[model samples]
Target: MLQPLPQEQTIMAETDRISQLPADIVDNILGFLPIEDAAKTVVLSTNWGGIWPNLTQLCFAPHFFRRLKNRYSTKHAAFYVITKILLQHQGPTIRKFEVDYYDSKTETVKSRSYDIDQWLLLVTRKGVEEIKLHLGSQEYRLPDCVLSCRTLKSLDLDSLLVRPLRSTYMLPNVASLRFRSINLDFFSDLVLDVPSLENLSCEECYEMFHLHIIAKSICSLNIRYCSGRELDSFIPVNMDLRSIRTLHLDSHSLQNFVDDCSRTGLPLRSPALNVEDLNLSDFCFKEETQASPLIRLLHICPNLIKLHISLWCPVTWRCDSTYDDEKDIPSVAEVDRRLPELRSVAQRHKRLVTLKLILFKGFWCEMLFIKELLAALPSLQEVIIGHSNDMDSKRKCEVMERVLHFPRASTEANVTCI
Candidate 1:
């Protein structure tokens, strides 16, 4: 039926054949093997010789480093060789690249500085979409050309110092940033123009950071530091609050911010953070004060869906070992009346779904406060009550009952006793 295959078609099919296998069969068969081994398949015949370097997402982590370390006596020279190999490959672009840098025992910051800039520049020139730079003690500054990176999206700096710049350094498209230790005293401050930014985290930076929130698409934020609040400074109550869905605050810098907000009456600076998963820890109190200075924390985030509290008093608040049974125990109703405005405030926020109570040290006086709290959260679904096992069984059971019975609608909700 086919009158005989054309001569050009026959010649094309024969040349497409590699060794003895047909073109389709060899290509399909080669896809199953590792790239290195697949390249070795070329030795079986004269048809295939080079194929491994064209992969889109090139990986150079564990295996590459091991081979380099065994071949070369110096680790620095090994890093250079690896850097050259990655730079040589062309045509097929890298979509994502991850450099898991682990320095040897004797390596120091000065040893790795020069080549790091070269490697960063190479990846930048290749148009890397997402980059992760994780380093240990050998801390290095960011490269000069990082601002020019056009396609970079998310960046995470763990235990790295961002070199202070005189001019406003703009990461025009970076969406998410997470860092552990950074010196931000001379760093540039600008409107972070990431239109798609969703998450941001900074931990253990002591300097006061001044940043205007310009990202209209932000959703989650986590900041842990001890700056930005002076007794005289007016910090507003989340002025730009509509876009945020969650926030976690762990700043021990101030004794009490909401009370400070109340005393100053600063709308621009209110301690109230509107979030779906709000967590606050007040670890800035001295145990020896005569009066209760930490009581006002209950009203801080009135609408938080989840709350975790841990309070510690200095040695002065610690009671003597001797018994004082004659002293009266405070009534739950009396403590409840002090928080009249807080419960009403919580009722307005629709996101309070869960509550967690973390009490570092507590005794008789604070228990009544805890019982009243169980009765306060109207829509609470579950509760986690944690206390050091400083008490015996009888007191623990009584404490457990207060938390378990309060959530009216949660018939099957869990109450963890820790």
Candidate 2:
């Protein structure tokens, strides 16, 4: 067998040397560079170019490096340059397209171009995988073809808003989805079945953030600032997400959560999946009592270990002429549901280890929130309280003493307060 000649060896070294790097090692290094920079390697030689097309993961975002270059140079062609690279890439192995378009410019005027649609079509047709689209603009939906694509894995639509968009598309394969500042008012008949999904996020849901999840594989999620008085339209009981792990919930009204709770198979009762972390925010300004969903989380997330909660222990009361038989003094719900819940893993229950309570106004007192939590979570190693506010000198000592002392309520258990 004759070995390759000198010229052949030299040419092969330039083009095929990259193949020598372990596959995972190559991906790790390429992962750090923007997709365009990663693609630029191809120009180095055929070997490096081939590495990009075979990349199982891709991230294309503007690194803030230019921000460090000069104090004033950053406010220029950064976004347009990102768009340019996305359109130029013609690879099929892309698993993630993270387009973080935050305006670094003070007064940058950008004109709309149809190039976004063209590039989107190219990726979809070639079986590009995950897409994380984050824009700082009020543009709500991407082109129909991009959203309607069938091969997406995870999508994060952040800082999105209402714009000129029409009714179209059904996502069949996208799991792990997110929508931020989105107006889905035009989405009347949207349906989805993303069984492979692991997370779903929605923010600023003033208008209906309409969509459905047929997947039970979700692990981390966030639904915040959703003023949709009725959540049945956004998330029905039929959307059984039993696999949730990390969850952040903020709804417009109590009705939103209750409407969901009333749904058949929608009591947050999913198959035995470990839901470990939960953050409940976006409290309703007016509520008769704590919503049912929160009460249900204690019962549902049997494996929850970390918790972050923000609630409105209303400083004011409603003058419902009929219900106000008693003089209206400030009132918060005496909800028993949370008292036991804070105890579920010791309220932190199920090996609950960390707790962060922010804006812990009335709800904690309603359920003896702090007392029950200190009682239930014996496994707690760290606790952050009054996080939203800093403790003054006197208050700091008082707060620390209470926290450290509570763990010893039974027989002087050991708990360090820092």
Off by over 4 Å in 1: 1-85, 88-92, 99-107, 137-139, 164-166, 188-192, 210-213, 226-239, 251-274, 282-303, 308-350, 358-369, 386-413
lDDT tens digits by residue: candidate 1, 1-418 = 6654698789967986657665446655664454335556756776544433533344455445556677775566556764665776563455455555566452544577777677768777877766666555425777756645767777666555565443544566777766555555434353344556677665665353444344665667666664543423222222344355666555352333434446654342223444467655544222212112233433444446665655443445443221133144343234334445444444443445676767634443344344444555566666677865555666666656644564443343366767
- RMSD score of candidate 2 (Å): 8.1
lDDT of 1: 0.53
Which residue pairs of candidate 1 clash?
Answer: 235-268, 235-269, 236-268, 236-269, 236-270, 237-270, 287-313, 287-314
Best model number under lDDT: 2
Return the TM-score for candidate 2, rounded to 2 decimals.
Answer: 0.68
TM-score of each: 0.63, 0.68
lDDT of 1 at 378: 60
What lDDT tens digits, residue by residue, belong to model 2 across residues 286-385?
2434444455556556687787766454445321121123334243333344345435535335466777766533222422456566676656666666
For candidate 2, the lDDT comes to: 0.56
